[model samples]
Target: MQSFEIDKSDLLRIKNALEDNDAELQRVLLQYHTSEIAILFEKLQPDERERIINVLPTGEASEVIAEMDEEHHPAELLVNLTPEKRSEIVEELDYDDATDLLSQLDESDQQQILRDIDQEDASNIRALLNYDEDTAGGLMNTDLIKVNGKLNKNEALEEIIRQSEEMEEFYTLYAVNDDDILLGILSIKDIIKAKKEVTVLELVNKEFVYVKVDLDQEEVAKLISQYNLTSIPVVNDDMKLLGRITVDDIIDVMEEENTEDILKISGVSEDEELSGGWRNAVKSRLPWLVINLGTAFLAASVIRSYEDTAAKLPIISAYMIIIAGMGGNAATQALAVTVRRISLSDLTDRQAYITVVKEFLVGMTNGATNGVIVAAVANWYDSNPMLGLVMFLAMTGNLIIAGLTGATIPLILKRVGIDPAVASSIIITTFTDCIGFLLPLWLATKLLL
Candidate 1:
């Protein structure tokens, strides 16, 4: 197979062909895989994408839609197709994928699409849709191979063969009792090696990791990554098997959770779409900026209080910015590390204490090193050793404060049930800015004045 990049030229060629209704060019698109075709959808206009989707085979079109980004509104493309074509594509989608697409549409649209699918698939999709989209149940797929533990090895093998024929892949076969309660998981290797007369109960491994339906998807991904599992089973309150969440779904959850954290850390709303209109971007960002402005006023007030001292020694104005900027940078360093640690797991009292102490020491050491360098530069610039000494002391004090506050704020927020990522940055900025400006000005007032 050959690979080709879908560049502007290729998009232009496809666009021109579609505009002209070029039959030969349309046939060439059929040769590309569904994933490649999906990429083309992103570059093409909505009408062109709809035309191509309508022209493709139903199964291929369904796969192409599935391959597109959920945020791109792939469900809208399905709406453009005729009812018969829409029904065919919807029927071909995996239950989880179909449910995800439908959930993105309006309630009436969701119901209309659901009515087109088979009764059994519709019921399964409805059941999945009932769970929170960030929970284990929502991430799981109903397509899995299961066998009764009471069955003989040959019977189990036959059942597995029958069940997996429609599935693209299977990693492990789940063994359940008559009540459909999950008993154990059997690896494919073990099943293949079992004697013909052996029972599945004899071969199944009872020690297996699984998640409850309500478990958060982040925790689900953590469990899968921690245990090195390709797929983890989902169970109800009674321990009845519901479905399996594969590694692919876990990857998606990881990406989403990471994106949300990054946005929150920057004081931006996670719900803000990257490709959304400027209006939405402003709406999502304005509140945080307002809070930041208020904090800026507070920092400015600190400077206003020291105006007499600044006016007396005008050179102090220049040094004030240097000290405050360095302090803010140091605090941000500590904040980043602390936020990541909190995300990994809940810290014990001992761990939290250790974290604070470590950051404090780091702050002290780094502050001393940087303060000495800046102190030397100040003395050289102003030819005043006393001025150097004052800067050194002020920088050292501000950095220690920075380190302490940065390390503690996020942990404190976590304790109070607040999302550390959301508010920690603003609070740390205020602490660093106020202290950063106040220390040098106050010191210069007493020493240099």
Candidate 2:
């Protein structure tokens, strides 16, 4: 086969055929230029889109539909088809993509489509759907190419030929026993290189890794990343072969994991899909804002507790905020770094202790530098040497404590079996503000007031 040479003329011709409802031209484009045919399908009016979809072979349509924007994908194509047509379309889609498309629709519609699909395919899709969409099983395809352990290379090649005739996406062939217990895996490259007389069991690599169906998708991605596997087999805890998770699914899983962590650290729920509607966006953000409001008052209440001390020395209010802000930034930087380390498993043995000590040292240096600057500026602005000196002393102490608190809070949270990442921001912020407020007010009352 030669590489496709698509040009503007090709696109236009396909568009013209779609518009004119010329079945012959549509057939030609569908046969030779799937990409061009897809573009034409996308350009058609709703009814025209339905006509094109109805006419195209499901496999070609599925491959073309998979190329669409996630938010505007096969769901868009499905809405125009009958339930039976939708099932046929889904049955031809790669497993992960099929699950994703059905998941986008209303619950009732999704169920209807699934109920009408082939029983085996529907079962696989349902199983994938049952797993959290962010896990290994959820991201795996059901199109595994498996063979009995007894097959010789010749027999295995024959099996693969017949299987590949119907299934084209497989990478590795899982060699399993009669009971479906996994024995090993053999890559297609190995199959091609081997003597045809050899048994698949002899060709299979028993040392190959597999993921359990229930494993977290992030862990699956980490394994794939660490080993650079193109596809990996997934199994039940009992070692029964399930299916293979592809590189493409791992990429999506990695993206979803990254998105989930980013959102969680921002105090948003993991399920708040960023592509959702306005109601969803607002709903996801408001709870965090409200919790922050209450937490803000906790920081504020620290100041209220010291109001008497502050009133006697108004200069403290002006400089205290700056001191507090400086401490907040240092703590936040430390917290973010530590949280990422824990998330990525970059913090190794006793490294958390090293991190704590380094951050405290950093805090001490940071606090002293900022305190001197704040004190000097305050002294010049207020002409009160005592107020300036108090600001200097308080900020330095607050910043050091901020560093100690920042590093330890997450470690402590992890020790207590909490999600250190999710709770880190609130803990770091509240600590810095409260401690910054109190330390400064204490220094002010003792020295300036």
Candidate 3:
């Protein structure tokens, strides 16, 4: 399919079609893919979105809703739909998409909507809702092709044909026992190339990677990425096949996880929507800002204790800001790298130790390089070798402190079960700032005072 972007002119045409109650609106919308329509919904008001959804066929509407970003509030859009239309759209959606939308609603709303859909679909959705939204079970769809492993190749093919009637597409077929215990997997090629009498069990690739139902979605993404899999089976504790998670779902999970990490690193809550109102923005961000302010005072207290030294040498105060700012920036660089590594996988004790040591050496080298430049500037300005020495010592010491705290704190937080991304920046900032201020002032007192 060709790529398409909804430019301003396209938006204007779409809006005009909606405004005029034009029958051509469907035609205009049909030109865009369902994903594009979903993007367009983000630009529309609630009522406008409702109108467009109402105008489309139920299956298309369902696809558009499924394609929407969660921040667009797809659940609210479903609620705004008329009950009969809502049920139709819900029924048209895949089990995973329908469950995700309903999970965002209140229990009463979810139940009411579930009652109106197919009993089997509702049951599958309820089963999925029981898992945390960030787990493999929640990410999987119950709609997939599976065949009895005891079946001969021809019988398995017939069974696949029967089961595939309900599914839109499938890349791999799961092999299960009579009790639904997952045995292995079969590619289409494996099935087609085998003799008619060959059993599915004989053809199945038994050594396949799979995830438990409760496995974290991030880990699921990692496994899928590591193995370059198109899909992975989800199983219960007893290895009973529950559902399968497709590559598309993993792609979404990866995007969500990456966005969350980026936001947390910047000290913003992941819940803050990019297009959210100021009130919501404040609600999401104010707490972190308050916490940062509290930490800022700790750095202030360090400066306060050295008031005499700073007062005696006013030039020391100016250099102090430079050192602290540089330290904070350098520490942030280390913290970002460390947090990214931790997120990708749990490091062994040896790996973690090596990581800290690596940052320490990096800090030392960078600190010395920057120190010489600052020391030279200080000597040139004050014509005092002692002041330059103090500056050099302060810069090098604080940077070393920066690297250590930045690398070590995240690993410690991870070990203690804290989200290193959320807490690391705050703690590292406090360390770098306090040490940045204290190092220069104390050195100045000893060497220059």
Candidate 4:
């Protein structure tokens, strides 16, 4: 297969073909993969994208739709196609993909799309649609290869071939009992290596990892990663296997979750949907800015209380900003690590305490090192050792405050049923800033005034 890169030149050729209704349009498009075509869709008008989907083979069109960034509203693009084309493309989609696409559409459109597909597909899509998009049920695909544990190796091999014919790929072969309860997972290698007389029950890995349908998708991803699994089975409360979540879907989930966490850490609302228009962008950000502004005043008030000292020692103004700024930066570093750790696993009370202590130690060592350096600079500049001493004490104190609050606030928020990633930054900043200012000024007042 030839490699291709979509660039300005490719975009220009595609656009000219689109504009002129050129005969070579389909031929030109066929050379690129659906994923590449989806990237092109981001630059084209919606009508042009709809036309491309209409012209492409149903299977390819479905992949294009699936591959389109969620920001482009692939659901809306499908709805724009003629009803027949829409139904055909949707029918070509897998149950999980179809469910995700339909869930993005309005209720009436979703129902219409669901109604248009085959009954079995519609039923599976509907079941998946009922799940919250953040859960295992929402992320799982009904398409999986399975065999009864009682089946002999030959029988299981036959069943696998029959079941896998339509699937693009499969990882593990799930073994189930007569009740459809997931007994365990079996490797395809184990099945192929087994003697013809051996039952699947004998080959099943009964200790395999699986998740309940209602489990959080992030937790599901962690399980797959920790166990080094390519796919994982999703079961109901009774342990009946409903579906499997593939590694591909987990990759998408991880990207989305990481993006959300990054935004939240920067004090943006997760609901902002970064894909939307200016109105949404402003609406998402304004409230947070206002809250940040409020915190700014609190920090300013600390400085106001020290106006007399600052006015007498004008040099202090320049260094005050550095002290507070360093404290905020240190707190942010701690916040990022703690938030990442929290996201990866549920920390035990002991682990949480250890994390706090570790951050405190880190803050102390870093603060002392940086503080001494700044102190040396201060002493050299003014030929006054007292100024240097005040700076060293203040930096060390503020950093300790930064480290403690950075570690503890997130854990406290998690215990209170709040998202640690969202609120921790703001709280940590307030603590660091107030102390960062207060500590240096108090030291100056007591030691130098």
Lowest summed lDDT window (length 10), candidate 4: 16-25
lDDT of 1 by residue, 180-288 (tens): 9999999878888989899999998999999999999988988999999999999999999999999988888888888988999898999898767899899999999
The TM-score that candidate 3 achieves is: 0.97
User: What lDDT does model 2 reach?
Assistant: 0.79
How do the candidates rank by TM-score, highest first? 3, 4, 1, 2
- Of the two candidates 1 and 4, the one with more favorable lDDT, higher being better, is 4
**TM-score (C-alpha) between model 2 and the true structure:** 0.82
lDDT of each: 0.89, 0.79, 0.92, 0.90
lDDT tens digits, residue span 1-449, model 3: 66766689978989999976546888888888899999888788899999999999898999999999999999999998999999999888889999899999999999999898889888988988998999998899999999999999889989989998878889889999999999999898999999999999999899999999999999999999999999999999999999999999999999999999999999999989988999999999999999999999999999899889878899998999999999999999999999999999999999999999999999998899899989999899889888888888889988988999999999999999999999999999999999999999888888787
The top-ranked prediction according to lDDT is: 3
- Estimate, for each residue in 377-439, the C-alpha lDDT of model 2 and write its tens digit: 888988878877888888888889888887888888887899877888787788888887888
The residue ranges of model 3 lying beyond 4 angstroms of the native Cα positions read 1-6
Q: For candidate 3, what is the lDDT? A: 0.92
The superposed Cα distance between candidate 1 and the true structure at residue 120, in angstroms, equals: 1.1
